[model samples]
Target chain A: MNIMTPTPPSKGRVDVDNFALSYDTLEGPVEAVSNASIHVNPGEFVSIVGPSGCGKSTLLNAVAGFLKPTRGGVTVDGEPIDGPGADRGMVFQQYSLFPWKTVKGNVEFGLKMKHLDKSSRDRAARTLLGLAGLTAFENKYPDSLSGGMKQRVGIVRALATGPKVLLLDEPFGALDAQTRVIMQQILTNMWQRLKISVLFVTHDIDEAIFLSDRVYCMTARPGSIKAEITIPLERPRHQSMMMSSEFLGLRRGLMSLIREESIKAMGGELNDLALDGLSIDLHGQSLADVL
Target chain B: MKVETFALRREQQTATGPEIGAETSHVRTVQSPAGAPPQLAAYLRRWLALNRRGLRAVLIGAISLALFLLAWHLLTENRVVFFIRFTNVPSPSAVYESLTRAMQDSTFFTHVVLSCRRILFGFSLAALIAVPLGLVMGRFRVAHEILFPVMEVLRPIPAIAWVPMAIMLWPTNEQSIIYITFLGSFFPILVNTLHGMSLVDPVLVRAAQCLGAREVSIFREVYFPASLPHIFTGLTVGMGVAWVSLIAAEMISGQFGIGYFTWEAYSLVQYADIALGMICIGVLGLGSSALIRGLGRLVMPWNRT
Candidate 1:
């Protein structure tokens, strides 16, 4: 696969050191993420997997310059991120394409803001749309497209701006199983061709293991890095490779790491009363024993 | 490989065929005859089939209106003296006769044209002022705080109540009437636009920011377009109120316009002409609202589905 436009060499390198964020509410400041440190080298694919409310999205948002860290710093290529710019592209889980614009129009938006010429904008948008297999939907509005198609357009729109890094917040979380698999494949193909660093946030263990070169597991809130696991899987991975023992072993290790944090996240919400029904029956036999 | 997968999906979708809605199935059953060569007839048949439900709704509305007219006719023709007396009320036939006469009279058209002009001036001015003000207030906290209090204090006072003050303020009756109409429509448009602005999804703003949109572009591209549907809602409601205020103001102060015509007919004891004037107002109000809706559809084509 030939690269349409060559990316700048060794540009996308993200570093977050001892990051902490707390938001104010009626009661007081609530801590979301604390003492979280992570980094992605240029042209690397990194995944952050944790239980809900583990601030995986917060970490991603900070990298995209959407939020200001209360403590510590975030930088890309040795320069601190002051605010959001075209250098870091973000794809939201909600398929946040502008409803008023067509797919191609959405893709052209960032380029337009960058003051690209009309012909160049059109060429860039069309090229990205073709790469995403959305040439048929170039003129279709975001509302008319299905979830999978809309997310594909979102990805294409983000990539059209030629960002050094792509930040995705569970971009495939809303898709059905079949569409999600296909989307993963499409995304990997695009990532390979673009040669850009990716910071993907997801709770799915299999998704994390399959897509990332390295996976970082975070503890429950206030979230911090729990473990960093390297994926030794070879490049150009196939769907059939998921059945291999090596893949299964990676999946098992990631799942247990996540399951422990998930249980802890639920600990505050689930009291003894909630677990009593699961423990024993009226006949004095434990429910687990009967099952 | 991706292309092949997409092609396979497309083939599957085509094999399954397009899904038809439950309402459309009945229309499909009443299809045009096979091998029919009359293109005009075939086209008409297809149109009728597509619009069967819409046609049924129109038929139902007409029947309901006929029933109301019959009840009114019966009550007046028999001179029924119940809790509310119909003895002095004009019969449906009398009103219809007067309507026909008024239709032929050039002066009645003059009244309608003058009234429509007032509404056009007042409503357009209201929309032009309110939309921008509302957008600014909705997006900026300082603007909202400064303007919102003033608006809240004045909003409770009806446009009809402003007629006297308008008469004293404006030099001419035409200006005063137009002012009243403006007062009637201004608040609804402003308030609804503000509401729309508040409802804009925060995630969208973040997405735009991530795409390198500055503050000005975000306001122009995201906030403005997102608030449009609510602005249209405001316009429709404001239009109705504008007509009400325009009529009231004209009846109070004007020498021309449909409202003045109706008041004049009542003074002269031409009860039938009074009814005719009211019918004219009804039809014109309905027509103008339909115009606004049509304009809305044109502007927001993506919202049609």
Candidate 2:
């Protein structure tokens, strides 16, 4: 929160070209991402969606510079991905908060990394926590937090750094369905206010279409972008749009892309959450903010 | 059935031997069966597990002392095992008298103070240096590679073996004792600290790092707290090793410590006095270790689990 010396204005234009990653296990090399090209504009909320084991998370990881691509890699703004640094803040699926640090402490950790004074950090942390409705839980540890609360803490921690882009890897995957919807709405609300580039990965297509400017569908095994569907739904996406036919049709289209990938990739795993019945609730957010 | 399933069945069949035997034994012992006693035993087992090695050791000491006293009284009275000068060895009452006498000696307290000062000095120094250094090595693989090899080469060398070097390097004889004690406990604390540092979750580190913290800041903020449980462990272990090496250090370096006093008693063939001194050392070491463990509990309450 105490970013006293702001970084010389961040460009926030994140781009990936021919991004590839593989892990050479004893069995053989498992190619996680392959020749994946995507661009997230300055303030675009783009979500990458695919079936399980489709390397959507790997794509997010490559953007975060956690994994170096064997062939081509990612570039944030203009700089080449070297090592994991503060320029791209990542929200891990596990809500990887330092269990010892409290919620505010975790949120303020990145700010402190910027070497801001304790007081400034505290103030900024409070503001961010307030935005996420986590101000009351500033001093609570992640272990004490519910799955949704921890994800909120995770988001605050990522956002606290004031990084150019926020990279999320299935952040709400572990939450209950009800909590997931609430968290998604909270995230979208925060994203609307922040206006920062977000590269979110999820297995849920409805979530992808509901929250993104564009949704990138990935292929399995040697993962590459299978399709990029521009979400035509107007923003700020209200709760009403979730019930609208246009939103449902857009959701169906994204699901179809994922279903095709799922059939080929997740051969045996049951797909119980059918396309026809699944619903999205954008919470009570109105059309005033997203645009 | 198939041979594979038949073999599996046979293995499973033999697994119930202990339970079956216990059941049969219970049947023979009691006219009727009740589950109460076994359940009570399980509760008692869990209770003991919660108390740990210190409590177990204390119980053993009490039992051994009781048995030893009972045997001493019996043997001396009946002359069951005729003594080669039972007077010199002393009976339980005589030993008590000797203990009192030793306590009354002004020189005895001096020895204790001197030994304690040496131990505190040596162990504290070891802890202060090893904790930070080990933390550095543990947190970074590069640091681990750079520093661990030298530490490994030095770790196997006994603390007592440093006596000659300590004496030569330091001007004062007391300095030698402190050095010896420091070296004795250094590696255990270092190793444990390193273990504590090394085992801190990488996710936690990254979580901190990606927030905007520099690499150095990550080590300071994340690695330090995460490594505390291990660091405290190292402190406890280092204290233990330091105590073990303290006597050797005192004997070599002190003109007036517990070790020297014990040695003097031995040279004079005062076996009963020597035994008393040995008991005092055991009591002192046990007390100090308990203190460290208590301190650990205060600082890292999470470890109690």
C-alpha lDDT (0 to 100) for residue B46 of candidate 1: 76
Candidate 2 chain B lDDT trough over 10 residues, lowest sum: B29-38
Model 2, span B1-305: residue lDDT tens: 24445665655565545654465534743223222323556657877898889898999999998998898777765546454545455566765787889888898899889989999999999999999899778766798899889999999999999988988999999889888899998999999988887688888877776776677788778888889888888888888889778898777666877888788888888776777777788888899989988987786543445
In lDDT terms, how accurate is model 1?
A: 0.91
* Candidate 2 CAPRI grade: acceptable
Q: Lowest summed-lDDT stretch of 10 residues in model 2 chain A?
A: A1-10
| After superposition, candidate 2 runs with Cα above 4 Å error | A1-11, A22-31, A70-73, A78-82, A232-252, A266-291, B1-103, B139-143, B161-173, B251-254, B266-276, B294-305
Give each model's whole-structure lDDT: 0.91, 0.81
Strongest candidate by TM-score = 1
TM-score of chain B of 2: 0.73
